[model samples]
Target: MTQQGGTWPDDSETVPLDSGSAPASFVPKSTARRAQSTRPMPQRVGAGAQSYPDTSQFPAQPVSASAQGGAYSNGAQYRQYQQNRQYPQYQQYPQNPQYQQNQQYSNGWQYQQYPQYQQVPAAAPAVAAAPKRTHTRKSPKHGFLALLMWLATAGIVCIMAIREIPFGIDGSRWVPLIAGFVPWLAIASALFLLLSLLWHRRLLAVVSLVCLIFQVVWHIGFFVPTTSLSDEAKQAVTQTDANGLPISTDKYARIMTFNTTTGKADVNAIINEVREQHVEVLCLQEMTEGFVQRLEAAGIDNVLPYHIVAELHHGDNGGCNGIWSLSPMQNVSGDLVEVDASRVAAATITLGDSQVRFVSVHPSSPTRGNQGIWGEGLSSLSSLKEYDHTYVLMGDFNATWDHANFRNILGSRFVDSSQQSGGGFHMTYPANSKIPPLIEIDHIVHDKGVVVGDMQTVELAGSDHRALLATLEAQ
Candidate 1:
């Protein structure tokens, strides 16, 4: 075979030997580029293939040696062609400039000038910073102590109420009346504690209601006017005349006792009732000079003129005791009984065919600072037993039947005209309030010789207590 001018196989070098061997046929790299370009692209392989005319720039492919080993040998173009026959239509674009320009396409990796979007620096992963710690505070045990102290103060007030007990020796006993505050405070405290203990249940509500009722009952007895008397010592000795003549019949007298509250509208109402009822004897407590003057001006005669105690010093006389009688009054004296100055008097009156003795007393009320005085006054008055001639003892003793002192008086020989005649105890307090009336603190008590004819609560004036009226019959 004749040799070509200059070009040789890229991987081959000529050697002067083996003249008897057969010469192989040459295949140009251009032909290979054309063949590769004309072939269809592979379906699975995403990699693309391009062709060049000159082998000087294109990468060379290694020759295969054996079919079993996926290699090639000399004079095996047919076999090699069959091996690469999957891409038959691939063609080289070295001869076509227009095709080369068409091949310049944007792959996924190539970028176009799309408004020059600046590649923002990728934000570093945010560090999970540790949560900031804060210090906390709390109240100490002393705070609890402060709260307890507040509760204790209220508790003490309640206890004071329970300690007050009504204990007296006679019907005219006033000891309990004076000592009422002690038990009152103590009971209140005990009740308060009980309520607190039961607070979590429906029982609490029930207990609270019970306590309220009990307290109401207790206060009704406390504030209502009552005369503590013992009948044993107050026996009506005899009925006699002013001349010591014994003339007796079933005749009686009307007596009334009232608390006028400084002679306001209440006193006027009391006086009006007394005038209407023709009460033979009228006893009033918490008397004022203006009120007495007004009553005197209103034709109230035979008033016991005496200044006893001064609860208040308003207008030269505040809460003083006085008695207004239709009969000639005697033994009119106003002195400090136990606490403040008070009035006491006796009068002999002719009732129809009988002569009756009337004793009026104004005792100190057991209120706040006057508790001691009330107790002493009640006891002192009960022990007097000075009158025995068909006498009627009536006044505002400032104690209630529920009190021990009042019970003691009941035990005495004195008869409660109201309880015996008026059916039930009549309460007279907080005149304007709608709550139930309290007790018969304003009272009429006499020895068994004097029978209770009638008893009632008269019309009220501007006073806190309604007027008490009683008619007694000599036995």
Candidate 2:
């Protein structure tokens, strides 16, 4: 077939799709420009297609014969098309302007172009590699430590479990109070871990919640206020002396008990706390001779005139117990019993028409062999009972209210001031510590004759033992 563009047709060359049409320039100048402007101009391909008038400027096609399996012989248009098909991103502009499909050419010939190739769009960006999850490889010995920690946790739980049985000695005594929060913490951790593992398990969630609620309810059932406020209010209303008249609380006494660590904490801070609270009777444990000297030197005797300090003779650090009073004290002496006795100091004070005996007892702590000593100290206090006079026993007993000896022995005769006043869970001793205290060992025990009112814990600076204050009124 003959070519309509400026040349006779070559059998090997690609013919126009509509070979009968004239070239792009054969149109009116404005129409030709409009056709050219129909789309954005492309970037330069190798060079302009050969103008037939300038056929000498044509570029040689990169041709290969058996160069590789993908190569072609004779530079066949179909073979070149096959190779060019691999890069589909590059578009091949068709011969004869696309807009000329409806237009009829008058007469002039149009030039044919060589093949052109350009990137119509850039190569699609490779998908970004997903971020890798970071993981820390624990040391082999960490497993051993974790196992030991778990064993310790289990052991504590066991001790608290049989606390009432006394199977583990001191660990079993008053330990259930410490167990209240442990199971709750463990349950919370387990629920979170289980959620990560079995998020869709409704039974597990329900069981975990039930267990948590049961533990909380169980603790509340045991440690909740045993003393009835209604009964206390009735007692307060009905309370009378031998004369059958209402006893006046206007004439009251504020007593405070604090363990001072044998002058380890700032004595000035303790003194300031006592003075700020306007304490009438102040008792201190771990009160040594040096502490007494320091106190007297610090003008404590001026504020608290009546002072009776016992001398410690137990362990090396076993300091004495002292009672400082605002009013005149009588029969003030140390409870120097046979075993674990030097830690007690007793005195008597008169408020209104009533005379109340105040005893400051600091029994041995429950550490190793000290349990027996603690028991002995407790037993000794149990013997010093007199129904004739009202008694106020206040100090660090070194035994929580949950102790068998405390409930069975001490509870047999006297009432805990905290229970009577509805003072819930006032854990004293081991103060100035970052870790929360577990149990209440410090107490203000009083005979039924003495009316116990609001009791509070005073946080003393620089001391490991918190100060306990209990309000007293005559009954």
Candidate number achieving the greatest lDDT relative to the actual structure? 2
**Per-residue lDDT of candidate 1, residues 1-475 (tens digit):** 2234764334343322111233333345443333334344333344643322222232232322222222122213323334344322222334546434433432211212321222334449999999999744434554464446346544544433433444533223334444433324435545544644443323433544455565555554333434332342123213444643223222544567777776675444554575556565666777776876777666554322222223344321127665565555444444423333365555556555666666666666665666556666666666544545665767776776545555455556665565555245555654655754544467776766666544567547476667777555554
Stretches > 4 Å off in candidate 1: 1-250, 266-268, 302-318, 330-341, 352-354, 386-389, 409-411
Q: Give the TM-score of candidate 2.
A: 0.53
Candidate 2 deviation (Cα RMSD): 15.5
Question: RMSD in angstroms, all models?
Answer: 18.6, 15.5
**Structural similarity to truth (TM-score) of each candidate:** 0.45, 0.53
Q: 1-475 in candidate 2: lDDT tens per residue?
A: 3235965434344322211332311223332232223243333346643211221122222222112212111223323334444544323333436424312321111111212233244558899999999855655565564445445445544534443444225433344345333433445535433652343434444544544464455345224544433344334434454643333343466678888776675778766765665567888887777877877887777557788877668472368888888778887777634336455678888777788888877777766545566666677777666345678888877766556566544555688877556545677756888866656778888887777666678777757778887667765
Clashing pairs in 2: 431-464
